[model samples]
Target: MSRKRLLPALALLAFVAGCGANAAADDSAKLSLDAPLPTAVPDGAKIVVGDPATEVALKLSGQYDKVSKYVQFANLSGGPQTTEAFRAHALDLGSVAEIPPIHATWTGLHVKIVASKFRQDPLNHPIYKLGVAPGVSVKTFGDLRGKKIAYSPGQAQGALILKVLKKAGLTKDDVKLVELPSTGDVYAQALAGKQVDVAPIGGVQIKRYLAKYGKDGASTIDHGLRDDAGHLYGPVESLEDPAKAAAIRAYVAAWGVAQEWIDKHPKEWIEGYYVKNQGLSAADGQWLVDNAGHPDIPADWSDAIQRQQETIELLAQETGNKVIEAKDLYDLRFQTVAADAIKGGAK
Candidate 1:
């Protein structure tokens, strides 16, 4: 069926199911940063791997239905709005890959780690690379010294570059990092013209420029990028996990379904969610839909928790703030569903 038709049915289902949320309940959400969102944590929910609740509300970063397909997972508008909701507790479940939630833990927010969305290599995402014009001879991370790198500030991918650079024996001091605002396209355009030595590309844009696009536009200076896995694992934090583990399973299950859908019907997925909804070109959207990490969500919450802790520690160091422990921020009890559902396949 066409997505246009599917959406109406989904919208009707959501309305019938009464799953939508009132954005008005979150007037303060607009002003504050995202805190841990509150969720209906059912008591004594069995720790069945991979079975998080299906009907819970969520505060997703970008529009998720473009990928997930299920309707009415009430959330903040998109990235910026959802982020603020996480800060304000206007949401019960929120997803972010880095920085925001890491900082939230320090303030003693109600957020807790329930589950994770693992990307094979975050650096490979167009959102995370340094794109150079064809004229630039910068092919490796070593060439970034004294070159201008433009990107959004404090984002996980940006910080990841710094982290990896430090591992590579460099730091922010090695390059001139230019902070851009909403118009990262302007930044990319700047890179294409060599105005900026390197314009950081995130998500599949990195893939597009590196593998698909012609050299006439842009190319990756793959020096600092770690193929460690080109995908990223976004942490889903929530407050009140009465079902704790079970809730996670449901989410993961649905995620798998959504991923399978993307694979089986790539064109529909791109058209319905990416090109039209996200306002990107078909090529850009296709790059995203095709390349997204479809690995099964890890049932072993410990690995994700540890990674989050590392991210938090990094955040603390960056901000010079008091420390926040992984144990304190992660509410394992809420992920009973995820614990119950995972069955060993993660790419």
Candidate 2:
């Protein structure tokens, strides 16, 4: 979970592309991948990605060549894992969320913003629901003020829930906050014959629950977080000033390839990228793409800069932390390179 601001052109691009960033891996060669370039990529533009440690991400080059620039990657896997990696000086660039970096920044992990990343549409209101076990008599957020809830505390959705609770006139102290290790299937251990009355289950988990329980889904569990909006993913690195600037250049160069491919093959994207994955049903994946994505490209770094400012304000208020100035969080010189590639055709 990274943070980003919405550029006006990005908003416009959303309207035009009608698909969100980070939707699916491109699977065609027709992808131009280098339309909006600021300059010709240097002969040695390479980047390192230490993201959520997903095997899919580690293997992204198979889906698109633009990502080849990221020839080296380190998987921090996530949570304190990524934070530790950053602190140990194992990574140059990684995408992270607000709270972790806020803490990391104090520990000498200086983060530099690369570009605007993906965010769930606040307006669209994604399908985030609250789930409860068999005997837990909870109906609304207010009902569980004193009940114990399980989530990946202090990150992504966990942070969002903290903000939501505060706004709802409740605090983390109001309920028992059990920090689940991560957000995957192993969560079953919590609910397996244990008094795990609550958990932050998602679509992946929900489907499994329904199939195993009664094929009808539990009736007690309902929607947890409703106001679906936040700055999502981005590329950031803990590097010396000189090295950070170098990584931004490489990412911008690669993003140029990704965006052009999306722009050029607008029609085939959902079908090609979504259908390629074995785990995702083509139909369901297509629906996810249609409902949540917008692929229209950004016109300039200025637009992303404005987005960074807006996101910083929202995040600061939400987290009760000091707001980082836009200039402090992001650098646009790399994006200038991307914009140039888009307009002049990739060099």
Candidate 3:
């Protein structure tokens, strides 16, 4: 919730769940920034939004101010807050993990994915480890049949847990889902306090726990549960307006710049955000710099959208049968713009 903050105070947990942008004329041009605005453009960019982990890059690069001149961005907390913003039509441009947009679509919210990228790297997969309580014996998803899980409904972790359940031939009814406060170190605290059987954690939380408890004290279950993508979205109403639409396009292009910047300057990013902002150690910062690759803002959705649709469908199985197709959720107008801005392609 704090502006430009990386992960929360709890190091390891924040590392796992920390949320994450910018602009230029040539970059904006790729997104049709030069398009003539409608005579009656909106007065201000008063949309509530999320942090999305890009605030640092956008600020450091000085692109945030350039884009904000046209599009007013109001920052919210993270995934849970952004989900509510979408539900209430309180946000124009927002960022969230995969599940929020799917929920919006099912609720008939006119939101579309403007940009997206897979969160995992094949070589350096994110450390979303499933750590069980000291006394519990949940070694795999199948072992979660009667266990209590730390879950935040409609968030990325919940969606992931559902996928693991499905793969293990288990259902939601087979386990006990516990809701934990998203603020601070709730996930780590819950696990340490023996409140939940299995807690999916990362970064500082994992480091601290493993150091104090050791592998024998706190067991981890690695089910190869990785590969999730984050999305930047906006309401259709704003996208239909000429002025806001231009701003949105410009933002998309600037966003690509910010994403590239993070990947290119991982060391600066770690120091500025992970170490300085999130209170992580030099070692923790270096780990993130080495592992958390820059996000991929896909220029083409043919393959990515299909993967997203499949992910949504898998989660929907737990939320009832209201189906949401890829066509209903994505606005691909900016794909070319993203392609123009990103140098190495959207991988």
Candidate 4:
């Protein structure tokens, strides 16, 4: 080829490459948080939700069938599984605490929380209590110093440990943090086996932990910190889709109604959810219900957002993660969706 012809060919190749790079950049661009959300769920709209507890609540309340057409409830929960699903585009929405959203942001997966719920009296109804291993002396938070504590970095339980330490006027250097997965009965098992001096244990595991190991000197003490941060979050890409956004809006409202139903119909919830679905005894179910107090879904997320900011700051400091804005992690368009749904009596 002549030199002039070759030069033109190279220029064309460069132009094409630039266009391809720009297209890729557009694909990964962040969705505008202020973008208008469609009020109505379009026909054939669908979302894969990973919230089993909510699934049970909806089923027990007889509200599942109403949203089943557009909502596919996957038997998936926790930060790890939910984040993986989000990465794979397998999950449209996930139920998790504040930590997952923060962690997701840090790991380059932008997510936004669409709904938030807290216990009516969060401090009194904390989701977790510190479980002390047999023969380990940890009567108070101060005693956590120099003791081995179970920690799961990207999980709420691990974040709770850091919060507990902060409340006690201690730092990570003050305690030996034992890296562990806070899944199922792992925390309880670790406590019983004396693998760690302390760990945060919640739900039925709290009762069973003390029951099975109480004689062996295992005990749980209230951490006295409010850890009731429940949220429904999705990847930015998923929430950006108009159909999925509308479906999520509807699901949030139904979720609020289901929560109210559970609070009102404790016996039914205990029987249908804890007893039959989870295989727990009726007594255990009652214990969980009494301890959970009542659900508090606030229309204003100001307080929640402020608390999340503090959490992000703390986690960022401890983990060397970038301190991102907590307000950006929430979609204010959904600020009142659940509350309005509950108020409208939409069963």
Candidate 5:
């Protein structure tokens, strides 16, 4: 019954090392350091993590050194819960969708996006579908008018739905919005169970639903709705602390190492996490490998930061809210430090 416990499995990092950014090794010889750089994650530093992917990377790569001892691995359901945990000071570093930090800023929560992942392929993108229950008559965005649509404010579904509506020349006033918890697969389940006429559901959940229900059961809108990027964010208080900030830099660097490792060992990742932990069939796991690629650490934040700003501005406009500047939402210091770490680690 809790809002935070929605899709418990999503936090499992089923497709962990297989989405966004590919790190490749050159033919150059590997460098061996006699001693780790001082910027390496400090010994036994406490950090909180809500993302299973980040947790997997940090642990599997053994990149964070002894800092894992201080980590509290929280199985937060989604961005909304992760944002709440960040606001409550429950976690030092967390990952959430693009909208949560904007909402956090609006609500006076001090948070900043430190790292991000982006995918260029449409299928690779975490595309959310506008689906209707089996018996429902809705087909396109136009049919959504006057219909009861699932709504989870401040989450990706809610934000993306607004964008879809704008493209269709419709607004919330044109549709009956049914508010729901912003965590988990409940929204997808709602549409599948016919509890709502139309809802935003992730592609993976839809794939699973079709695997269970027939292809005709849960119908998806063919509209080209997609999200290309997700963010790893942290509390501003922690980011500003000299020690914690340094630790975060090291964490992002270590993450790059982990991502590089996954890129080279796709089979191990699919067999280990997807098939073993998530129970996906080998074929399905391979499907993920082919679609959801490995994430890369952004070497620079200028362009990505601008894109995040544009997204926030669009969301604000679609929801009839005042526009917010990207400058207010992000801190780019980690980008520089992470670049240094990734370079040093790669060498």
Candidate 6:
């Protein structure tokens, strides 16, 4: 071969090798959970969130426009639907209790919690109370020993039932666990029809259950456990994307601000969220407001993580599932993002 021809061929090979190295680098560029989160949402970055309550809160609080540029809210919530959405890659964020993330991990879906909220006075404003079926005599947790308690294994309500049983010193063998879906008014309906002797019910269900079945001796009693665990979580893949991560950080900040707005302006929240959006009566809305206490967003998630660890242990024991470290379920890089945003009034 001629020297000139050989030199050009060698140069072309060198250029191809360089291009291959750059492509490899790009392919390996995964986000580190320990690294600091990105600070800006790149142009055209978008996140699909399945958190209807937050969507309404943001709009009513007038903070929707601030995040609407990069955020799209979907009418989705709860563990099952959110997990399904995550599996289909249709949802970037979801609002759920502490259970969904744990269950998702068990089912082989990697996820992380970006924001956490609890009731200010969690005991006084417990998320659910034990609804006793008509003609069932369950005045205390001890009474639950022989009663058929409604249970939903993957949801928060199911975990709460387990916590209650542990508190009562009763094992699953001691009580009849009627596995039921706790969506909508199923628990309430179970109580009304006497299908289950006891089930955990929250919000307006507590008031309506008694009003309709008081004559038949239906009642609700405080379970005396702290069950107010609210969180915004997302798939690890979504959080690893630089643009989506930045957008999530911003949405979390806006979410924290919207929580504060709802706490401060109960009337408007009741009207906009409960009465108008949820199709509940004004009295029902007011009742929810009266019962909701206040929002407590913590800058530090150590205590929350520890509590989650305990829950994981309990669930593992009951369901015979592998126990996981709660810390791994959280992305500590976002530990203080929402709290700082609320304090700084960013939205």
The numbered model that scores best in lDDT is 6
Scored by lDDT, model 2 comes in at: 0.47
Q: For residues 125-243, write the lDDT of model 5, one tens digit per residue.
A: 55666777777777767887888888888887788777778778898899888898744578777877777888877746766755665466667765575566677777666654444
Give a tens-digit lDDT track for model 4, residues 53-145. 889988877788989988877766778777776665567788998699999889889888999999998889989999999999889888999
Q: Per-residue CA lDDT of candidate 1, range 76-147, in tens?
A: 222343344444333445445555455554554445455555555544432355678666767666777787
In model 3, where do residues sit more than 4 Å from their true spots? Answer: 1-49, 87-89, 120-124, 344-347
Q: List the residue pairs that clash in candidate 4.
A: none
Worst 10 residues of 5 by lDDT: 18-27
Tens digit per residue, CA lDDT, model 3, 182-203: 4566777788788998877765
Better of 2 and 3 by TM-score: 3
- Candidate 2: deviation at residue 249, Å? 2.2
What shift in Å separates residue 187 of candidate 1 from its native position after superposition?
3.5
Please give the clash total of every predicted structure, in order.
64, 22, 11, 0, 7, 0
- The TM-score between candidate 2 and the true structure equals 0.62
Model 2, which residues run further than 4 Å from truth? 1-45, 51-70, 75-79, 106-108, 125-128, 188-195, 214-244, 256-284, 287-291, 295-327, 332-347
The runs of at least 3 residues in candidate 6 whose Cα sits more than 4 Å from the true structure, single-residue gaps closed, are 1-27
Query: Which runs of model 1 end up more than 4 angstroms from their true locations?
Result: 1-79, 87-89, 120-127, 182-186, 193-195, 207-217, 223-238, 241-257, 263-267, 279-283, 339-347
lDDT score for residue 2 of model 1: 36
lDDT over C-alpha atoms for residue 305 of model 1: 67
